[model samples]
Structure formats: C-alpha cells, structure tokens
Target: MNHVISVINQKGGVGKTTSTINLGCAFANLGQKILIIDLDPQGNASTGVGIENNERENSIYKLLIERNNLQQYVKHTKIENLDIMCANVELSGFETEVAEDKNRAFILKGIMDELRQKNQYNQILIDCPPSLSLLTVMALVASNSVIVPLQTEFFALEGLTQLLKTINRIKMSLNKMLEVEGIVLTMFDKRNKLCAQVEQEARKFFGEQVYETLIPRNIRISEAPSHGLPVIVYDKYCAGSIAYEKLAAEIIEKQKKFNFAA
Candidate 1:
C-alpha cells in the first residue's frame, strides 16, 4: 500500500522543502520506493535533489496542465528507490488554467490513481507552495495525510488556524479520508528563551498533534540546497540530518500504529 503525504505550510521558511527531501531520501534508504512531487513553482525540491530545471522538458507543470504523460517527467534521484517529479516556473499558470474545472480538486488524485495502478511507488510525497492557492488545495485533495511544519516564532500559530480550516473543508468536500500526520516544529533554537516559550504555547494548544522530534536550526540545512543535495546526503553528521532521521523514525512508528489499528 502507498502512503501519499503532502508537506505543507501556508507560511514559508519553515523547512518544508528540507523535510520533504530528507524524508524521501531516508525512506528510500530504508528500501521503500518513493516519489517526490515538486508542487511548488519555485522548484527548490528539484534542485535540492540535484536535478536542474533547465535540463528537463516535461515537468509537473506540463503533466498537470496539458495532461501530458508522466513517464518522461519522472527522474531518478541519487538515492536508490527514490524518484522525483520536478516543477518549473510554468506551474504558476495552473491557478488560472484549472479554475473552471470543478473536478480540478481531483486532478492530482487522478494522476496518482494512474501511477498507483502501475505500482510505481510505495510512498508519494508532495512538496507544496507556501500559500492557500489552488495548487495547495489540489495537493491536499491528492494526499491521504498532511505534515505541517511550524517555525517556533511568535506568529507561528496564526496561519495554522486557517490552514486547519482549509484542511477540514477539503475533508468534507473532496477527500473524506484525509488525516493530519503531525505538526513538526522546525528552525528551533534552544538558546532562545522565546523559542522555548513558543514551543510551550504550541504544545498547550495542539497537545498530541505535535511530533516528539523538533528540528533545530542548523546552518547545514540552509546550505544544502545551494549544493544541490539533502542535508542528510550533504552532511550526514550534521544536526539537521540527525533531527530528520529521528523524525523519519517517528513517522514510521505512527504509520505502523495506523496499519495495525486498521
């Protein structure tokens, strides 16, 4: 069975792309076939995995908008059992293009159904844009679960309310089985008293919805994308790599519980 997850945050700079790449890589290393869909128009996920946007012809944009074939667009990453669907600047136009189609909410789900029928991937991860646009909505519709990443800042919980509301709306209207995977606290600095305060407040509000693994702020994480690699691949000993590996374990445990309960 495939677990399709969308890493989403309406507020950017919360390490969404970093989490996506690291989880994909870690899963692949564990011998699972993984596919990362770069839904963000910025294409950071593509570059983070060492794929150049200019070097590709059929990206996710063409596959979504023109209903083009996905066979050529899917490319293998450096890690074994991991593949990627790169995005380009052209994906920005999908907001207007899929506007009139009522079933636009299910476009991504339709594509995933086709891919699943082919038994291509065991897990599909979507890296979405940092906004409440149609792209994000489509990603939510396509995903069975969503992982929300939050920065431990003062305004961290502000956008979260709206994001949860949107998720609830999507569940009722489009995806009845959608579930929130968990809230991951990212970019945390243990030295900052304010960060600690923010963490306490978030825990008070969200309770068990937050993950046990909190990702610390590390310079290597920010530097990895420029080098076209995930932090785990770029520097396995870095704090970011260690944190993400812990997160991967936590995620796997939760999935096991879900499976057993079923």
Candidate 2:
C-alpha cells in the first residue's frame, strides 16, 4: 500500500525539512521505494537531497501548472531508494497564477492520486513551506496524514493551537480524511530546563499524538544538508540518524496496526 504524508509545520525552523529528508531516507534504507516532494519555494529539501538549483527546470512547478507528468519531473537523489520532485522560486507565484480556479486546492491532490494508483512508491513525503497558505491547504488535501515537527522553543505550544485550528478547518472544508500521523519534538536540549518543561507540557496535552522519538539538537544533522546527504547516510551513528531510524520503525509498526484494523 502507498501512503502520502505531508511533513508540515507552518512555523519555520521547526525541523520539518530535516525530518522529511532523513525520515524518507530512513525508510529507503529499509528498502522501501520513496518519493520526496519539495513543495517549499526555498528548495531546501531539493538541495538537501543533492538536487541543484540549475537542475530544477522540470520541477514540481512545471508538473503542477504546466506538464502533469511525473516521469518528466521525478529526479533521482544520492539515496538508492529515494527520488525527488523539486520546487523553486517560481512556486511562490503559483497562487496568483491559479487565482481564478475554483478548485485550486485539488490540483495537487489530482496529480498525487495518479502517482498513488501506479504504486511505484511505498511512501511519498511532502516537505511543505512555513505557511498555511493555499499550498499547505493543497498538501493537506493530497495527503493521507500529516507529521508535524514542533521545535522545543518558547511559545511553541501557542503556535500549535493555531496550526491545529487550521487543520480542523481544512478537514471541515477540504479533505475530511486528513489525519495527524504524529508530532515529533525537535532541537530538544536536555540540559535546558525549559526544553524539559516544553516536552512535559506537550506530552500532557497531546499524549499519544506525540511520538516517543525525540530528535536531539545535533550538529551533524545540520551539516549533512550542506553536503547534500541525509543525516542517516552522512553519519549513520549520529544521534539525529538514530532518532530518525527509530521514527521510521515506529511509523512502520503503526502501519501494521492500521492494516490489521482495516
């Protein structure tokens, strides 16, 4: 079965892109076919996986507003099992280009459904931008579920409330099946008392919605992207890589439970 998961966090610097790249690689390391969609205009996810800016002529922008062919856009990354559909600054103007379309949100969903039916990928991970605009709405409509990364910073919980409201509103109006897969805490500094407090409060409120895995603040995780590799591949023994591997395993286990129930 294929699953499309949007790695979203409207708030920036929450480790959304980092999680998307490494988690996808983690699954790939398990021998699963994965496609990573870089939906952000920043193109960090694309570059993180070694897709250069000059090589994005046939990126997601073309796939969305121009050519709707996956083969024309999908590009291979350094990882054997992971492929990517990139994005660039042109994506920022997409909203204005489709302003007259009544069903703009469904554009991405339609394209994703085609890829889903082909069953080429076991997992499709979308790295969304840091805003709840039409792009994020489109991602939510296209995804089976979303995985949010919450940074252990002050006022993190306050921002989560607003994001949840947006998710609920999207569910009410767009995709009713849109579900939250889980939330992971990022940049957790155990030496900091405030980080511990944030984790405790988050667990108290979110409970089972929060994953048991915690991505600690690690220099290797940040350095891997500069070298255009996932942390798991850049340095497999790093804390970030270990946590993401655990996250992928947990996600697979959850899928088993979901399949059994179905």
Candidate 3:
C-alpha cells in the first residue's frame, strides 16, 4: 500500500519544503518508489528535486484546475525511485480558481485516489504551502498522514497549534483516516540556548508526536535548492542529509507497524 504523507506547517521558515524533499529522497534511497508532489506555489520542492519550474509544461496547477491525470504531470528526478509533480508560479492562482468549486477540498484527493489505484508509487510525499489555504486543505484531504516540520523557535510552536487545529478540523470533516504521522524539529542549532529551550518545550507539549531526529541548521541544506538538488545529493555527509535519513527510517518503521496491524 502506498503511504501518502504531507509535510505541513503554517509557519514559512519551518523547513516544510526541506523536509519533504529530503525525506522523499531518503525514502527513495531505501528502495521505495516515491513521488514528491509540490503543492506550494513557491515550488521549492520542485527545485530541490532538480525539476526546473521555468520549464514545467503541465504542473500541479493543471492537476488542480483541469483535473489532469497524475501520470501526465509526473517528472523523473535524478534519484532512481523519486519522481515529482512539479509546481510553478502559475499555482499561485490555483487557490483562487478552485475557491468556489464545491469539491475544491477534494480535488487533490481525487487525483491522488486515481493514482493510488494505479499503484505507481510506494509513497507519496506532498509539500504543502505554509498556510491553511485551499491547497493545504486539498493536500490534507488527499493524505493519510501528515508530518509537521517545525522550527525550534517560539513562534513556530504557536503556528503548530493552529496547524494542528486545522488538521483536526479536516479529519473531522473530510478525511477521517488522517493522522499526525510525526513532528520533525528543523533548523535546530545546538549551540543556541533558544533552540534547546524551544525543543524542550515542544517535546513537553507534543511528546510522542515529535520525531527523535532533529534537523540542525545547515548551510548545505539551504544551498541545495539553488543547484536544484536535494541536500542528500548535494552533500551526502551533511548534517541535514543525515537527519533526514534518520527521519525516513522513523517514518518507515511506523508504516511497518501500521501494515502489520492491517
């Protein structure tokens, strides 16, 4: 069964794109056929996976507006098991376009359902925009699980509360199977007292929802998008790459338990 997961955060700087791209790559490295869907207009996940947004012909925008088939939008990545549904600036209008559609919230879910029935991927990782807009609602409706990438900062926690509330609302109203897969702490700097304090407080509140692996603030991760490559491919030995691999394992282990229960 394909496990569809979304990396979501209402806060912009929380590393949602970074986590989605790297964790998708890491899962591919473990021999899973992974599809990374760039649901953000910024399309950082597209660039992170080496898909040039400037060259996109059919993007997630088309998928949302035209109900484009998932196969038509999939672009191959340099990584073996990783493919991407690229997004571009055109996606900025997607929310407005779908705003009035009665089934707008399930647009993405409908596309993904068709793809899942086709059985083309082992995992689907969606990179949600940093908001509770229609796009995020669509992604949440499409996904079975959500991994919230949070920054170990004061405001990040507050944003997380709002995101969790939105997820709860979605679960109650749309996708009943939706669940919090895990929380990943990102942009962490061990040398900073603020980072430590924030992480401790997050653990106190989120507890088991937080992943064991913490992504440190690493320049390599920030630089990789400029080169249109995931941090793992840009610098395999980097701290950010290592953290994502650990996170991938954590996710896979949880999925394994779920599969056994099923």
Candidate 4:
C-alpha cells in the first residue's frame, strides 16, 4: 500500500522526530521510495536528515501557505530513496495566518490526495509537532495510520492514555479511516527497572498494538542530528539503527500478512 504514516506523540522528547528519520531511512534501505514531511515547527526531522536551514527554500510552509506546485517543495535527500518536505520556524505562524480559512484542516489532505494517486512512494512519513495543534491535526487528517513512539520513562504511559483519547476523537470525527498502526517503545534502558516495567504494562494492556521492536537510548541517535543525518546513516551498527531496521522489516511483514488476509 502507498500509505501515509505519521509518527506522532503529543508529549515531547518521546523520540518522534528520531523515529521518523531513522525508520524512514531504514525503509528506504529496504528499497522502498519514501517521502518524509517535516510537519513540526521545530523542524528537527528536517535538520536530523541533513536538510540545512539554507537549503529549505521551498518548505512545508510554502507547500501549505503558497499552495504552489508540491513537486517543487519536495527535496531529494542524500539518502538513495528518501525525499523530504522541509520545515522551519516560519511554519509556526501558519495557524495564525490561516485563521480565517474555513477548510484549512483539509488543505494537507487535499495535497496528500494527489500524492496518493501518483503512488510514487511506498510510504510517506509525517513528523508531527509535539502538540495537537493545527499542523498535527492536518497530519492526522491526512494519514492512513500513525506510529506512536512511547518513551519508556516515568509518566510515559500516562501521556499515552491522553494521546489515545485524542486519536480516538480524531478518528470518530475528522478521519474515519485513521488508525494507530502500533506503538513502538522508545528510549528503553534495560538498566533502568522503570523502563522494563513500563514495557511490561504496555504489552499487557495493548497486546499486539505495541511493536516487538524496542529502541534503546543510544548516544549515536542523539549525535546523528548534530551531523544532519539519521543514526542508521551515521552508524549502521549502532543499537538504535539496528532497532529501526528491525522495526521496518517487521512493519513490512505485518502489512504483507494483512494484505494476504484481505
């Protein structure tokens, strides 16, 4: 399926941007053409994947605000099969600027509709901002499914309960087809007892809704963004990179199973 998956978490520091970058690249390495839309105002995903501030001439801001040709906004990354729609601080003003537009929520959906028809990429990953604002709403409205990164730290599950409620509300009203593909536990530290406890509770409650692959807290993952690259590209042998690779493989296999059943 030519699916659009938004990597989202309302709570910050849950590895949302990190997952979007590394996981998208992992899928690309698996030979799937991928497009990453940096929907975050912070634009961490854009910076993490090597799109410098100077390179972002036609960003998501222009794509949404200017409503020009979407093709011109899509920038091919150094990665072989991955492209990006960059973003920066200018995107923070989009909400106030489009305040009077009655159909603003549907703007992203309309743009994605054209892309879906093209079927140029196997998957499109949207890096949503930390809050459930207009941009996050737009991503949710446009996405077929979401991949939530649940941090294994204290109060992580508490935040997820609220996020799930938000997802349900959006599903019932905005996009009836939207679904949570699965929850991937991130920042897992085996040394921390709390991390393991959190994982156990999540698996017990969510069952198959949580992915088997867990992303450990790694220095390389943090360091990659400084170099404007994904952890997978910076150090393929690192634990964080390996986990994303496994996650990508699992996602492909799971989709194949569902397709066969259908």
Candidate 5:
C-alpha cells in the first residue's frame, strides 16, 4: 500500500523541506518508488531534487487549479525511483483563487485519492509551506499522516502545540484518518546543552511518537540544496546522510507494524 505523508511544520527554518527531500531520496535508494509533492510556494523541495524553476511550468499550482491529469504534472528527479510535482511562487495565489469554493480543502485529497488508485508509488511525501494556511490545510486533509521536523531550539514545543491542534482540527472535520507518523528532531548539536535538553523534553512528552534518529547540524545538508541534490546523494558518508537513511529504515519498520496491525 502507498503511504501519503506530509512533512510539515508551521514555523519556518525547521529543516522541513530538507527532511522531505532527503527522506524521499533515502526511500528511493532503498528501492521504494517515491513521489514528492512540492506544495510549498518557495519550491525548495523541487530545487533540492534538481527541478529547476523553468521546469516548473506544469507545477502543483496547475495541478490544483486544473484538477485533472496528475501524471502529466509529475516530473522525474535525478534519483532513479523518485519523482516530484514542482511548485513555484504562483502557488501563493491559490488560497485567494479558491476562496469561493467550499470544497477547496479537498482538492489535493482528490488528487491523492486518484494517485492511490494508480498505485504507482510506494510513498508520497508532501512538502508543506511554513504556515497554517490554506495550502497546509489542503495537505493535512490529503495525507494519511504527518512527519514533523521539530528544530531543537527554544519554544520548539510551543510551536508544535499549534501544529498538533491544527492536525487535530483537520482530523475531526477534514480527514478522519490523519495522524502524526513521528516527530524528527532536526539540526541537533550534541555538544550544545540546549539541544540535549530539547531532545529529552520531546522524548519525555511525545514518547514513542518521536523517532530515534537525530539529524545533526551539518554543513553538508545545508549545502546540498544549492547543488540541486539531496545530502544523501551529494555526500553519502556525511553525518546528515547517514541519519536520514537510518530514519527511513525506522519509518519503514513502523509502516510494517502498522500494516500488520491493519
């Protein structure tokens, strides 16, 4: 079965796009067919996977507005089993454009339901914008679960509370099956006492809902997006790359348990 998950965080600069792109690549490397939906107007996920701005003419914006023919919008990334539906600044206007439609929130969900019928991908990851806007609502309504990239910093948990509330609101009214897959602590610095403190607090509060993998504050991860590549592919041996690969394995194992339970 295909799993559709949104890599989401309301606060910006939390490694949300970085986690989405790297995790998609890691899943692909593990022989899973992955489709990354660049729902963020900034299009960082598209650029991270090597989809240039010029190539985003048929982007997620068009897909949401046109509302048909999903395959025509999907573009293959440099990775073998990874694909992406690019997005650009034009997507920022989507909220205003769809204001009159009461069913606007289900637009992406309809597209996702169609994709599931095709069964072309093992995993679909949506890179949500850094805000609790209409786009984020659409993604939350479409996804089966969410993977939150919680930055290890002051007020991290405070920001997470708002996001969790939003998810709960969506689950109650929009998507009944919506759940948090796991919380990934990003940009962790082991030597920093605050980072360790944040991790302990997160594990204590969320317990098993937080993953074991901690993505370190590595320069390699920050540099990979400029090179239009995932850190795992740019430098396979880097600390960031190893962490993402391990996270992917952990996610897969969790999925197996979920499937068995189902």
Candidate 6:
C-alpha cells in the first residue's frame, strides 16, 4: 500500500524540511519509490532535492489553485526513485484564496486520492509549512499519518503539546484515519545534557511513537541543501546520513508490522 505522510512541526527550525528531504532520500536509497510534496511556501524541500526556482512554474500552488492533474506538477529529482511536487512563494496565498470554501481542507485530500489510484509510489511525504495554518491542515487531512521532527531544545515539548491538540482536533472533525507515524529527535548532540533530557522526556511521554534513530547536528546535513542534495547523497557515511538511513529502515519495519496486523 502507498503511504502518504506529512512531515510536520508547527515550530520553525525544528528540522521539518530537512527530515522530509533526507528521509525521502533514504527511502529512495532503500529502493522505495518516494514522492515528496513540497507544501511549504519556502519550498526548501524542493530546493533540497535539487529543484530549481526557475523550474517551479507548475508548482503545488498551481495544483492547489487550479486543481490540475497531479502528474503535471510532479518533478523528478536527481535520485532515481524520488520525485517531488514543487512549491513556491505563491503557495503562501493559498489559505487566503480558499478562505470562503467550506471544503478547503479536503482539496489536497482529493488530489491524494487520485495519486493513490495511480499507485506510483511506495511512500509520499508532504513537507508542510512551519505553522498550524490552512496549508498544514490540508496536509494533515490528506495524509495517512505524520512524522514530526522534534528539536532537542527548550520549549520543544511545549510546542509539541499544542501540535498534538491540533492533530486530535483534526482527527475528530476531518481525517479520522490520521495518526502520528513517529517522532524523530533531530539536531541532537550527545555532549548536550539538555538534549539527553529532552530525549528522555519525549521517550517517556511518547513511548514507541518516538523512533530510536537520532539525527545529530552535522555540518554535512546543513551543507547538503545548498548543494541541492540530501545528506545521505551528499555524505553517505556521515552521522546524519546514517541516522536518517536507520530511520527509513525503522519506518519500513514498522509499516510491515502494521500491514501484518491489518
């Protein structure tokens, strides 16, 4: 079955886009066909995967606004199994543009339903904006589950509480099947006692909902996007790359268990 997951964290600078890109790359490396939907107005996920700004004329904004064929918007990345529906700054206006529509939240869901019929990808990751806005809501409504990238720092848990409430609210009213796939601890530093504290707290609260893989703060991960590549592609042996690869494997294993149970 094809899985549609939203990589989201309302808090900014929490490695949301980074996790989205690298995780998709890792899944591709594992021979899974992956499609990353760049829903963020920043379009960082698109840039991270090497989609140029000039090449984003038929972006997610057009797809959302025009309700066009999804295939027309999907752009293949340099990686063999990875593709992306690019986004641009114009996506920032989507919320306002659809304010009066009662079914606005289901728009992305409609497109996703079409994608599901094609069965072209093993995984589809939606890179959401850093806010609990209309765009984020659309992503949540469209996705089967979410992968939250939690930064190991102060106020991280506080922000997570609000995000959880939002998820529950949407679950009750919109997407009944929506679930949290896993929480990834990002930007971790072993030397930082605070990072350890946060991880402990997260594991205590979320239990198995938190993945074992920890994405460390690495220069290679930081440099990859500028080079228009994922860290695993940029520096495969790096700590960050290895961590994301492990995360991909972990997610795949979890999916197998879920499928078996189902």
Worst 10 residues of 2 by lDDT: 253-262
Off by over 4 Å in 4: 260-262
Candidate 6 residues lying further than 4 Å off, grouped into runs, are 260-262
RMSD of each: 1.5, 1.4, 1.5, 1.6, 1.2, 1.3
List the candidate 1 regions with Cα displacement exceeding 4 Å.
260-262
* lDDT tens readout by residue for model 5, 1-262: 5689999999999999999999999999999899999999999999999999999999999999998988999999889999999999999999999999999999999999999999999899999999999999999999999999999998899989888999999999989999898999999999999999999999999999899999999999999999999999999999999999999999899878776111
lDDT for model 1: 0.88
Q: Clashing residue pairs in candidate 1, if any?
A: none
Over the stretch 1-262, how does candidate 1's per-residue lDDT look in tens digits?
5688999998888889999999999888788899999999999999999998676568898888766576887999887898999988989888898789988888888887778777778789999999988899999998888999999999999989999999999999888888988899999999999999989988999997898899999999999999889999899999999999899888888888776111
Error of 6 at 40 (Å): 0.4
Each model's TM-score?
Answer: 0.96, 0.97, 0.96, 0.97, 0.98, 0.98
Best by lDDT: 5
Which tens-of-lDDT digit does each residue in 178-244 have in candidate 3? Answer: 9998898999999999999999999999998888899999999999999888999999998889988
Residue 79 in candidate 5, Cα distance off native in Å: 0.4
Expressed as tens digits, the lDDT of each residue in 50-164 for candidate 4 is: 9999999888998898775879999999999999999999999999999999998888999899888888888999999999899999999998889999999878888888888
Displacement of the residue 25 alpha carbon in candidate 4, Å: 0.3
Residue pairs with colliding backbones in model 4 are none
Comparison by lDDT, 3 against 5, better one: 5
